[model samples]
Target: MGGFFGAALKRDCVEDVFFGTDYHSHLGTRRGGMAFYSPENGFQRGIHSIENSPFRTKFEKELAGMSGNIGIGCISDTDPQPILLRSKLGRIAVCNIGIINNAEELCNEFYDSRLASFETMTSSKVNSSAIIGALIAQKDSFAEGIRYAQERVEGTMSLLILTEDGIIAARDKFGRLPIVIGESEDGYCVSFESFAFQKLGYKTRRELLPAEIVRITADKIEVLGEGNPDALRICTFLWTYYGYPNSVYEGVTVETMRTRNGEIMAEYDIQNGTLPDVDYVCGVPDSGVPHAIGYANRSGIPFARPFIKYTPTWPRSFMPQSQEMRNKVAKMKLIPVHELIEGKKLLFVDDSIVRGTQMRETVEFLYENGAKEVHMRSACPPIMFGCKYLNFSRSTSELDLIARRIIHEYEGEEGVKYIREYSDSKTERGKRLRDEICRRLKLTSLEFQFLDGTVKAVGLPECKLCTYCWSGKQD
Candidate 1:
């Protein structure tokens, strides 16, 4: 997953575009790019790797030569973008924030038809944004081309394009990702996160519906096409884990929803007589704090920080490319508080236990520091399948997930038929799954927020949300 921002302003929009794109740094870590268009300079673009440094630090040097009234920028985990392309639609700077699963097939089709050829990157793959441009060029106008490109792409795609006239913004077809407009004194800006613009002294204009397309100028936002709200399937992970605390999507704030989710989980535990006796209720840092706070408030357990993540050296969302390094760095970031962990019965609420690598390390570290018992609460249900839409889980295979691994061990290929049962604690199979995970992780107890409970916490009709990672169902 990634994010982008664009500004068409009365004055030079360099600063606005720079900070707005930088505000989305949490979305990706691979590459950062920006493209600007001015009457004098025409179009100027820059792309740099952000694996070692942050978005702001890496892009700040380019600010001297970059200036424009209209610009588009993005933070991407895959290919470099805000790519400068000249086509029938004109020279437009484009960048995308979603996955395109069928790239190879589409590229092969393009090659076979002899319509056009594609340029591959260092990874020996075509840039997704470039492929989008090719698809859009197949039609006559930008609106029709946009609709066409979206229909062809197998996965999610939300994009920002910088043209001489202004900027064109389009949300993904199924609305798996969100795009919002913000109004300021100078002009309007577009972003995936509402907070990104609000912090830039811009007022909330409106959020684009699923598959909507719009063109933004300094004064007005013209709707190029309307979106279908009936087919809405916005990603649920945005609320539970990926989204920033201040971020809001589908009219619900992330922090508010997380707090509410924890409250709902506590209510369920209380009703089921499963609320554990713990000396302290602790959150697994960062995203988990709000959930833990809500759990603590509802269950009347004293909330404490038994261990803190040393984020100064390693940013909360900063990820290394390799899994081996990720596990090593994750362990190095924890700084335990002996006063809080010594002889304490700790119950930790985490955003989600995907691979359970970090959680296992954390629980083991606590026991080493003298904790009597370590219980765990996952804010979301066990992920049954790799995310097909947003690629949020980053799992190359289902075996990469701890839940899937357990299912494979017990039932082999037969486990695929009972994913729902394995996800539910009420089922005997689900109970067995929990016991096995607890034993492996060296935990005293374990529980996950049920699928229905999570939807209830989100306060959205089930038909409108995407729970593919957990339920293996699409809207």
Candidate 2:
């Protein structure tokens, strides 16, 4: 849901940190922050709200006055971060990328023990970065403190800590997110997205293992603690939606995985004789394009762009807080091509259908534009649970998901027992769910990628992947 970039260089690294952090603008829309440490100026930090503007536009002026060889920056979807703190471990700036599910409990524990007190934000919520800082300061050393925090946190926590010596980069305990290191002649850099540093003349050095902690200096890196390589359960949504197309994680490129996933979906449709007779195969745009391309290639259907995204003025559709505003923005970004949609039988592939509101509107828009029959395909299995580890969805309750809502309506509270069956398209419950969704969305037909198919598309061991959102299985 968020991303971070850090740099330790022999020379001034302000520009590197600025552009590097800007590359992660797609990760978060709420906040952007940067903190740099210099011998003369100590730590110069700046945090800005990016809800109304882009990260680059908000931080451009501050970059001119900031200069440091060691620095860290982040794009946060929640609380403002790169929080500067003074602790027993000395002054350090911290930024984290994961949610703390048990934050209230931890805060209560801190209050009960008289260990720490938190400052409330405008929304009356505690700043997670401050809590993380307090947690890190509990132990005698930074390394021990980080480990303690990781062990105590219930959910994911991958972080970057900037100290006077250098920067400390730690991947989450379960490796739900990615933290990669890159090398260059001037120094080394760390980033959540691999492509961020590659543009700055840095080659792939290595990725931090799950729970691994490493310190980065200008010319060297020291391993503070090793990670449990066997305990990886990286979130599968990265390749499906969150990750940049050019980025590679665990040696798998996002675009490559998406294309393969589409191919697999197409192959399945063909084998089952479910391939529809359509004039064109189209994607929802942006993230959905690659999947549609693969499907078109595998099925020998021409890939067409029925609607183009106009991004020059509008931000991401999901960036807004209000559902109504988001829907409006989503509609404004898509400019329909009448030539492609008029009297055409089109099949549309989307990354995934969450609440299905936008998708329903999209199908209706196609029909209004003279689409003859609109068939829909989901690139992944139905999302059965709202993600607990990442801020991928804005839905706060399980009922916010269309699949969960449908299940509830069918079997009331007892449908939970048949979740696995419902995920299988061959099962009666799954078939009913699909038909219900199709009727509601006014689609001619709908099909979702099988769970096993998605796993195969990622090309990772099933044990090493997190399929909690689809399967509701956490191991």
Candidate 3:
């Protein structure tokens, strides 16, 4: 995954551009880049290979002597972005977030046509920069080109383009990703994540609609096109894993949704008679931290980071391809802080447990440090079905993980047939399924966020989100 930030300002926007882009460091670990357009200089692009370090430290030297009235930046997991392209329309810098599912087919068609040539970077299938360039080259007008691109692309995209005249922001047609605008005295800012506006004193403007395109300059802002008001397909997984705590994608804060999820989980526990009175609440580091905070606030318990992250060795959250290496790295990254765990009945809040291998190690670590009993709470229910839309490459096969292990033991040879039932929230079968899962994991108790609670917490109607991972439903 990657994130982008762009701004058009009255004053030089280099500092704002630099720091705003730096705030999206956690989204991707491979590359950090920025492109600026100044009155004097046409367009300047800066990229830093940040595989081993933070974006701030890696791009600090690149910040010197780089100034522009309008600029765009990206933290790329796959390819370098803010690619400067010279086309029929003119030179424009482009940055995009989201995956293109039909990339191979499109790339093959383009190659066969002999009308366009793609240059620069390739990973997985089609290169991101090349795809954006191809999209831009497909039409006569910048707006029309991007519109066609949004229409033709199979997957999600949230893009920002900086030209000599102004900057344009466009969201994907299905709205699988998020894009929001911010404003300050200097100018208007557009970012994939709202956290970019934190220290810059930029106030929140309205979020861009799915497939909407808008142009921004220092003195003017215009909507080139508005998104379809009734489009019903926004990615629901954003609430569970992708979004920042301070960020609100569709009018719901991640923190608030997480709190509601915890409450729902607690309710499920009450109905099932599995609620345990623990000394305190704790979370696995990073993403789980926010959910744990929400749980503690709701349950009136102290929230602690008993398992503190050793980020120096394990800087990135999403691991590289090797499974054996990733498992080892996950344990090394979280060293147990025994001070919080010693002789305490702790409840651990986590986003979700896909493969319980790493979590089992974590629980053992807690016991070794003198934890009397450890209870587990997950924000969302068990991921019974494998995610088909996004590149959820962490757990390769569903059968190799915890969900499958429990399901198989409970339903015998025909367990896979009952995956949909296990994911359902209201059904008595779903409740029993969760209990069996808890027993298998050797937890004091376990509960999952109800499907209704998750949808309500996200603030989007149930129709918009992709609950395929849980319910096996697809749009």
Candidate 4:
């Protein structure tokens, strides 16, 4: 859960690099960084903490100062990226998107071989810089270096290297993360998410094929080597959880799909006669806000933000593992506006209901603030399955909540029958089950983000996305 954007431009690319990377601020809050190469400057790197500050504010001073033709930048969730490294290969700057699961083993291997010592950050992992540097040191060529890094890592990684000669963009072999190329009058841009491209007046050149590596210079963008195209595995969770609405992956637009999801939820509300007489419809926060906008537009209601996010504190989307800490953090991060909620029957849309503990507390706080009634709508169905691919980072278990407990009671056994109801949101039994679950959550009403609606919301053909978290399907 971090994102990066890099570019090799025909003209000075400092503005594109800074703003493109800033577009990914929603992805990570720990650190923001940028590095660039110029014949005179060699490699320049800048890092800032966005925890108490925003990327724009923190990097304002560096924007004009860090000018170059080729550069790389990152919004890092775990550690600062765009790490400038001096190795036998060359002086290079590295940035990554996606996680490396085998950091410990690789770190130890580097240490045992007396190759390098990694710098530890607040997160306690071997610096991603050191890991990428180790890979660079192991190979003779940039392509080989990336291939070595992709082949050895367990999880996903889409990376960019700004070397003394040129820039290299590489995606993980599985392509569990996304990387795309953009072309402008200036030069070429490489990024993990496409949202950055549109704002910069750049058009997508092409998506970097899975396990593909390409090196770019002022003259041309060249494919270095192919990792493995047939290993066409992409993470399924991007649609449901982490990705932004404007970003595109696998030829699908996130905003269109989420809007479709909103339309479907509106229809379902009408069919069930659960539509409430609400003054305004609002989303829980950011993720839920898009769908709420669609819902309000379709349902002909005002879309309001009853609770303003306390961004100063609760800015990060996913937190480190700790329930007590997360709960406290969540509470401190949101402030309810009594003026909006008081005497109003509010319909609130959210991305998903995980454990529902945080949500329950949130709703109760709304009521205490004088909300006449609070109706709940979820963009996606209940998460009966814990994500196997993602760190999830929020809740550890699928069964640690009301949905799983109710399913257990209904089946009296955790077997095929119980699992089937949880997946089928349209089944009469499924409807009854969700109704009961909603009653328990103390929501006046609740509607799951349907599987079809979710697919449409993601704007992807059925074959591209991994719906395993919702349907219990495994690839």
**Candidate that would win on lDDT:** 2
Q: Summarize candidate 2's per-residue lDDT along 333-378 as a digit string, tens digits.
A: 8899999999999999999999999999999989999999999999
What would the TM-scores of all predictions be? 0.99, 0.99, 0.90, 0.84
Error of 2 at 354 (Å): 0.1
Ranking by lDDT: 2, 1, 3, 4
**What's every prediction's RMSD, in angstroms?**
0.9, 0.7, 2.9, 3.7
lDDT (10s digit) by residue, model 1, range 109-202 = 8899997797889789999988999899999999999999999999999999899999999999888899999999999999988888887899
**How far does residue 31 in candidate 3 sit from its true spot (Å)?**
1.4
Off by over 4 Å in 2: none
Clashing pairs in 4: 257-457, 258-457
lDDT (C-alpha, whole model) for all candidates:
0.90, 0.93, 0.78, 0.77
**Candidate 1 clashing pairs, residues 3+ apart or interchain:** none
Check candidate 3 and list the clashing pairs. none
Clashes of each: 0, 0, 0, 2
Q: How high a TM-score does candidate 3 get?
A: 0.90
In model 2, which range of ten residues has the least summed lDDT? 312-321
Q: What lDDT would candidate 1 get against the real structure?
A: 0.90
Tens-digit lDDT track of model 3 for 1-475: 8788988999888889888998887778778899998878779998887876778887787777788889988998767887888888888888887777788778888889886667645445556767876876889987898898887777666788899978999988867778888999888999888878867989888888778899998776799988875674666677777777776777778777777776666666667666678888887776777777767776667878787788875676454446677677777777777778899999998888887777777787788888989888878767776665554434566776677767787787798788767777457767787677666666776767767777866778788777877777766
Q: Which one wins by lDDT: 1 or 3?
A: 1
